[model samples]
Target: MISLRRQPMPSTRVLATRTNRKTRKPMQFRGASIAFTLILPVFLIAASAATQTGEEGSIELVDPKVLRVCADPRDLPFSNEAGEGFENKIAALLAQKLGKTLAYDYYPGATGFVRNTLNAHRCDLIIGMPQGDDIVQGTNPYYRTTYALVSKQGSGLETIDSLEDPRLKAKRIGIVAGTPPATNLAVNGLLGNIKSYPLVVDTRFDSPTSAMMEDLEGDRIDVAILWGPIAGYLAKHAKTPVKVTPLVKETSGPRMIYRIGMGVRHSDQEWKRLLNKLIAENQTEITHILAIYGVPLLDENNALLTQ
Candidate 1:
């Protein structure tokens, strides 16, 4: 989890994107304000072309020949240097639809991700961002997802869906600290027997989701609550059968679901519109790619779109 903050639940972090340049020293996290160090590297599918700029206040803020994306190079199930994440696939799809070469500005999706990459003019697009993210303008949402509870088969915990289920009171749970689900656990008094993983880490070395899943598989933790994409993808690929129950029934705290969209510079309305069109026209293919990666897709009404 690179700690890409989402609004509404301001402390909620989205897991996504990059590769080893240098791992930053751990920074102190206080309240909801987090300070972090970032790694910088650019991956280009073609040589850099002249910036296609317009007069001041123009909406043309991108390079015409390349769809330059800001992405994390090591975070899998989302993105990685090998172009294996769902975001990477979607970026490639958009680039092809736009007749532009795909390029990437790789950086850890840590605190300064948008500030250093997209805002710095190093790239023009971010493949995945929570809708309504304040730092960058967001296009129309491409997919909706929710937090999910993951448990190994035969654990008898698969039947538990709501956080308010009484059987959960006696089981140990694993969760990423500071996520919206943490608040739900707190309100339900389930934090008492929980293991809290860090919200931010260098993806090159640390994977909170993988560690949590390992614990759950080993019976060290009875269940793990994680973001839908990560939980669903990993469970689908895990060695043994696993059950993923989307937590759509949370009646308190921040809502468990989110809409994800592409991000662009605030001034680049043209770029945003172009992306929205791409999303609309190729939505079927996009959904297919997500399904291949095991993302739990949802419709606007929070209903499941895929099994």
Candidate 2:
């Protein structure tokens, strides 16, 4: 009677016991699920908050919905808020991509425009910033140009390549006051030879090239160093065919090749990134815009500099 006999456990009974344990364990599982349900929302909320904070921190302080742009009201081949210039087109394109309307701040071209307008937050972007302007941060250049010596055709000025050419030594060359060309000539020791013009009110005229045109026609100046677009347009449409010879050497002026970029506040890094992306995305459109303003599609190298 003290020795117990081993009996086989019924398979159904073993299964029933396991099933009971599983049924009881469901309650434990339900508690764990309830706990997770209570904690998960808080965890998710914290994660979402961190993500939003990071996103906000990464962008500049400026509102993404409004893009304030700056441009000279009278400068041609560059900007005019009246929507008549290439820079205006570029600005419009940028605004379109950003899904924002442009707010333009116009100012006369003075030495202090950058500080008075851009730094003062009068505008968020300057459309036609010269490359390497330290006053405002610049993006990658979207256009390139050179100073062209424009003169009446068949003037035996078939190929003037440099400002220092002996043939131009005694010639009166018309130059805009306070421009890079004028400064370059002065710095390269050619200022004395150049016939300088003050900031003539007529220079702000729709066709600023008229000053040079009058000078050339009047024989008051043998040649003029004007921006490529102006020179090209003048040459293409002049009563007398003007020969536009690009200068290749620059001892003091901008080298034959210079780039133009958009300007933004140094602190508006997010805007800058957006602009850079837009520029890259719209290269073909930008090229078309520049061509509409008469920028040459190729340089002396004959390479396709634009799309």
Query: Which model scores highest in TM-score?
Result: 1
All-Cα superposition RMSD per candidate: 8.3, 27.7
For each candidate, give its TM-score against the true structure: 0.83, 0.70
Which portions of model 2 show Cα errors greater than 4 Å?
A: 1-63, 177-193, 199-209, 251-256, 296-307
- Which 10 consecutive residues of model 1 have the lowest summed lDDT? 39-48
| Candidate 2 overall lDDT versus native | 0.62
How many residue pairs collide in each prediction?
4, 0
Q: Which runs of model 1 end up more than 4 angstroms from their true locations?
A: 1-20, 23-59
The sequence of per-residue lDDT tens digits that candidate 1 reaches over residues 1-307 is 3344222244334433233444444333454332222211121211122124423213355567888888877767888789998999999988888788999988767667777788877789888888877778899988888889998889888899888899989999999887888888899998898999876565557777889998888889999988888898889878778998888887888888888888888877767777788899999999999988888888867777854
Model 2 clash pairs are none
lDDT for position 42 in model 2? 84
lDDT (C-alpha, whole model) for all candidates: 0.77, 0.62
For candidate 1, the C-alpha RMSD (Å) to the true structure equals 8.3
What is the C-alpha local distance difference test score of candidate 1? 0.77
